[model samples]
Target: MKRTAALVALAAVPVLFLGVFFVLPVSGMVGLGLVSDGRFAPGEALEVLGRARVHRVLWFTVWAAALATAITLLLGIPAAYVLHRLDFPGRTVLRAAFMVPFVLPTVVVGIAFKHLFAGALAGLALDGTPVPIIAAMVFFNLAVVVRTVGTSWESLDPRPAEAAAALGAGGWRVFRTITLPALRTSIVSAATVVFLFCSTAFGIVLILGGLRYATIETEIYLLTTAHFDLPAAAALCLLQLFVVTLLLYAAHRARAAAPVPVERRAPGARRIRRTDLPAVLAAGVALVLIAFPVLDLVTGSLRHDGNWSLANYRALDQVGQGSLVEASVIEALVNSLRTAFDATWLALLIGGLVSVIVTRRSHSPTERRVRAGLDGFFMLPLGVSAVTLGFGFLITLDEPPVNFRDSPMLVPIAQALVALPLVVRTLAPVLAGIDDRQRQAAASLGASPLRTVLTIDLAVITRPLLAASGFAFAISLGEFGATSFLSRVDHPTLPVLIFRLLGTPGSHNYGMALAAAVVLAATTAAVMLLVERLRVPGVGGF
Candidate 1:
């Protein structure tokens, strides 16, 4: 009973925080959708649901997500296998390269894709459609495959593959018969994650697609904010929520279906054959795939009027002739930095506390239940489309108890919501690795609980803590969807600024947008480098 009480006390913080912030906001959106103009409109919602356009958009969303997932898996499985099995030089560097797109702002990605495939970009052309956008989406999300599958990839024992080879199975047969089965859990996990990203994708679709295409997310934003059709927006939100819920349910089942096999061999030590042509070619292609987009962004930023010049960069601070360019670049940059910093620290504190509490009682049933429930809620912000959350926040924050309709902190708070999951996932594993014996040793030595954490726990967690917080900071810095929804008219972030620049039909505007995107990309890359430098021993960095 005493232990249960203690567990409850610990779990209370996360539950209360999530109940107020996460659950209430989403619930309010659903309520708003149903109780519009004072009376319920379930029939209107049902009718909207049956619209042909809605069906078309839903079909498009599923197809696009599936395509993206397939692309990630095709490229990622081999890449994951190579990284998991190969012992070569630059392995860590290759791993970091995979993670770059995951951290790059979607808006920046969309912009980069546009620039890459634009008529003026190295005179390259790709049939004048949004094929570039789809390709970019697949490339940008490849990290999901590597990170998720790579974890399981690392955990795989190579003896199975080796034994299969000894039994007269060819390399292809061995991979199909043995390696594929061993990677089922990681593949499913990675695919679900990639699908979630693709379905809810906004900035990439907006920038690369323009009016040519729209995901469910971009359409919702366009319908609600641009058209002011709350009903249609609500309907879209509901449809999206249903689909996402189904996807997440599939993910949950995939997770439950596969039991991770015990590895007799060290996962880190696994490697692919050095002379394998497929592995080498895949690695080379991946390197080019990752490097070219960034190179395109950088080169575009530096060139101007058929000659290299820094004029576009120099004019980053000036506001232009319309509402789209209402805010200066300096203002946007400062606002982004300030807000991202605050949100990172805020998330670190809240998420870290929740993680520690969740791990405090390993054997308490009540604690386990509470942790599981809270975990789902915290992770909901990740899977729940950003546009949905943005609309929810807009409706709920306009009146009453919390009026942040015009608040500056609103953007970062949204960023924090998106980033909190990253922080928790990163820190939770590190915290879980803390042995009970260490705490018991401290306690036996007359250390109080606080002191034990301060000394023993602090030493172990500091490195991962830095890396995690740094990742949260980087994520918030480049975050775009929530930034678009919550950005105050007077203050914009770098991404919003870049989007506005790209929206205009002038060379200078496009050039300046490219410049700002270059800056955002460079800033993100530098921070990731910092994260690696600060990574604690034995705990993987950001």
Candidate 2:
């Protein structure tokens, strides 16, 4: 009885928190759009479905996402193979450096890409085109494929492949027979994630595509803010939810069907083979392409009025940021840091509690399925996107019990909703992987359950917890879609301020935007690098 009570109490924390913050808000916003005059309208839905513009936007979104996913796979698969198969100088360093773009704020990426292709600094700018937008999606998504696929690729045993090769199998035949089948699961998982990200891309589409291009994401922003068509925005949100859910369901099925076998050998420690050279060289070129815009952003930040200058950064101390945004760059940074701190605490607290519940005593298949459902519940925020949360907050939080519409707390609450998934993903695996022997040993030594958890489980989970905290912080710092919509005018975040600065017309505004973007990117990279140093070998998605 006591044990059941404790489990229920532990589960209540995350359930209540997520229910109020994430579930209610999303339901409110999505529900309001699905109804007309408080009545369900099947005809309204059909009208939205039949609209020519809606179909156009939806189809374009599909085409763009498909093309972008294909490009990412073509680039990322060989890169993953190199990282998995070869030993080379600075290889780990190269891998870590390449990861910078993935964590970078989408707004900052848009800024860097715009300047590289459209600014006078590049001599041959490529702005206001689908090419730059697709390129930006590819830039941000390559790391996802490389990291996800590389993890599985590295652990694969080579004996089967070697035997097949020795038995008169050719290069392609050996790979087709052994390697391809083994890697299909990771490839599909990676590809699904990349496709989802590209499909829901916002800042890259907004900035690079100019005023003409519109995904369902950007259209929601346009309909809500620019055109004041709330109903249309809500309908678009529904359409987006439907598409994303179907894709997620498919990915889940694929992953469950193709389970990866455990490998007993150390990854990437095998003898180097001749075929690795091409993979290595391809990874090298990919790294250069990944690093170019970031390095160029740094250069642009320091170059003011055609010469090296600190004027752009120094002006961060003043109000308006040389734009009409009213907030200084320093203030924006402070707001972002503050939000990251609060959001990380909220996510870790709630996510850790939920993870404990999910990892708690479970023997039956029914119990395991319930735990899995709970896990997916926390992660629903990622699939739903921050834009939906922001919209939901506006629609739902004006009432008495949850009336935080005017408060600054909503900023990080939205961020926590987004960060909670990563926190759980980081901590749950470690928690579940805890050996039963350790706790049994502690109990044998007369340790209480509480003491055993503190001593054994806490010690093991601390580093991954810290890494999770760092990820939450980095994610909050770089968040743009929701922040742009939800943040208060006077208390804008760094990403929001950068977006505003980009809109103002002046050399100073442009330069300052570049400087702030570089600062944001650099800080995110620093956090990731620090966490990488602290991370253990087989933890969560770093």
Q: What root-mean-square deviation over C-alphas does model 1 reach? A: 2.5
Quote the positional error of residue 188 for candidate 2 in Å.
0.9
Which run of 10 residues does model 1 get worst, by summed lDDT?
Answer: 533-542
Score every model by TM-score: 0.93, 0.95
Candidate 2's C-alpha lDDT?
0.83
lDDT, candidates in the order shown = 0.77, 0.83
Give the clashing pairs for model 2: 117-125, 117-126
lDDT of 1 by residue, 1-542 (tens): 67667766866776776666667778877876777788887887888778877777777777877887787778877787677667887888877777778888888888887777774454556723657767887878887787767666676787888898898989889878887777787788788888888888899888766555778888888887788977778778887888788888888898889766666456465345544668667756766777887888788888899898998898788875353757877788888889889889878977898778656645667757866775666667655777887887877877767777877777777787778877888788788888889999989999998999999878888888889888998989888886787887678888888888777778777777888888888788788877867765334332
Against the true structure, whose TM-score is highest?
A: 2
- Model 1 residue 207 lDDT? 76
The number of the candidate with the highest lDDT is 2
- Model 1 misplacement above 4 A: 120-128, 267-275, 321-323, 362-368, 534-542
